[model samples]
Target: MAETQRFHDRVALQLDDDGVAQLRLSRPDKMNAIDAGMFAGLVAAAEALQAMRGLHAVVLHGEGRAFCAGLDMASFGRMSEGGGVANGLNDLLERTHGLANQPQQVAWAWRELQVPVIAAVHGVAFGGGLQIALGADVRYLAADARMSVMEMHWGLVPDMAGIPLMRELLRSDVARELVFSARIVDAEEACRIGLGTRLCADPLAEALALARGVAGRNPDAVRGAKRLLNQAADGDAASLLMAESVEQAKLIGSANQREAVLAVMEKRAARFQD
Candidate 1:
C-alpha cells in the first residue's frame, strides 16, 4: 500500500523500483470524479513525474469502479454567476499548472514528460473522464469498459480539452455525433472508434507489462524516441520526418544503444550507463 496520508486530497502517487510511477485516481466513493481537490492531486502527480530521474514510464489509473465520472456536479455548484468568479475562471485559461491544466492538458502533462505515460482504464469513463483517458499516449482498457462523450447529456460541451485530442483519434463526423449525442459506448466500440489502444481483461496488468518492457530498454533512447514522437504527433509531415532523423542520429552512436544491440546478440542483460 502507498503512504496514503502523504497525499493531500484526491489521488495517490507512488513510485516503484522498476521505473514505473503509478498515479491512481483515489476517490472510490465517488467513482473518481474530477473534483477540485482531485484536480490538484492530478497536477501534483504531474510535477512529481517531471522532477523524477531515471524514470522510464508512468501508469495512470483510477482506484475504483469508474476510471472517472467526469466532473463532480456538486463542485460545479460552488461557483456563482458573477464577474469575479468568471474572471478567476478566465485566469485559469491564461495560466498553466499541472492541476489547472485544461482537462485534456492535465493528462497531456504526462505526455509532456520525458517518459512514456500509459493509462489503464476500466469501468465508466464519462465526459471529462473519457477525455482524460485520451490524454495518455497509450491506453489499456478493460473489455467491458464503458465510455462516453458525456457533456451534451448534462447540457454542457466537453470543455476539458477533449476536442483537440479526440480529433486525432476519431473522424470528424464520428467525433461530432458522439459529442452531440452524448452516446455511451463499450470498450469494444471504443476500440473500433479509436478511443482505445487495446482491450484486455485486466487493464492494469497489461499496462504494467508494457511499462516493464519499456523500462527494460535503454532509458535515454526511449526518452529520445518519446520526444521525437511527441514532436511528430503535433507537427507536420516534414517536421515529423526531420524529428525521426534527428532522434535516430542521437541514438546510433550512443554507448547505451550500442550495448542494447550487443546485449541482444549475446543474450545477456544490458550493462547500461544509467
Candidate 2:
C-alpha cells in the first residue's frame, strides 16, 4: 500500500495494494467546489501521480455530497470585481502544461496520465466539475447524479478542457445544445448522451472494482492500450494502425505477457510484475 498524501488540503491520494490509486476531492464542507486552492491541489495531485511507480489505474471521486460544484462562488465574485476577469482570462490563456493552461491542466493532466483513470460521480457535477470528470477515461455515475454544461449559467464558457473532451464524447449538435441551454441532465440522459459509461447505485464501489480488474492485467499491456486509445482520439488511421503494431511488439514477449499466457493455461491467476 502506498501512503496517503494530501494536496493543499483539497485533494487526497491513496494507493491500494492492487496498484489502484484513489484520488478524492476532499472539501466536503464546500461540496468540493473548485477554488484557487482546489485548482492547485488538483494539478499537484496529478503531477504526483504521474511520478508514481507501479501505478495501474486511478479512481477519481469526491469526499462530499457532490463530485464537485463547479467554480466556487467566491471565484465568480472575484471575476466580477475590477480587472479580475481580464487577469483571469489572461492567466488561462498562458500555456502552462503543454496545450493546456493552468485551469485546463487541472483536468487535462488526468488524461495525460499513462494509466487508466475512472471517475465515480454522484450528486451534482456542474460546469467545471463535469469537465473534470470528463477528463477521465471512463465515468461511472450514480443513478441520482446530475450533470450539466453549466458555464453558460455563469456567463462563462466551459474552458477547463471541457470543449475538447465534450467533443469526443458527444455529438456536435448535442454538445451545442447542452452548452447553449446549460441544462442539468440526469444520469440516464448523461449515459445516453455519452457523458457516462454506466449508472450504478454505488459508483465508487463499481469504479474500485473496475480499477482492481484493470490492475490485475499486465501493466505494460494495459498502459500500452491506454496510450493507443488516447492517440486514436486524434491520430490518423495509418498512425493508429502503426501504433497498434508498436504496442503489440512491446508486449508480445514481455515477461508479464508471458505470465498472463501461462496463468490462463494453468487455470490460475496471473502474477504480473509492474
Expressed as tens digits, the lDDT of each residue in 45-137 for candidate 1 is 777778987688988899878799887755333321111211123233332543323344565576578888899999999987887788788
Which candidate should be chosen as best, given TM-score against the real structure?
Answer: 2
Query: How badly does each model clash, as a count of residue pairs?
Result: 0, 0
CA lDDT of every candidate = 0.72, 0.81
- Give the clashing residue pairs of candidate 1, or none: none
- For model 2, the local distance difference test gives 0.81
lDDT of model 2, residue 40:
86
Q: Model 2 clash pairs? A: none
Q: Give the TM-score of each candidate.
A: 0.77, 0.83
- What candidate 1 gets wrong by more than 4 Å, as runs, is 1-6, 78-92, 98-104, 235-274
Model 1 TM-score on a 0 to 1 scale: 0.77
Model 2, position 36, has a per-residue lDDT of 74
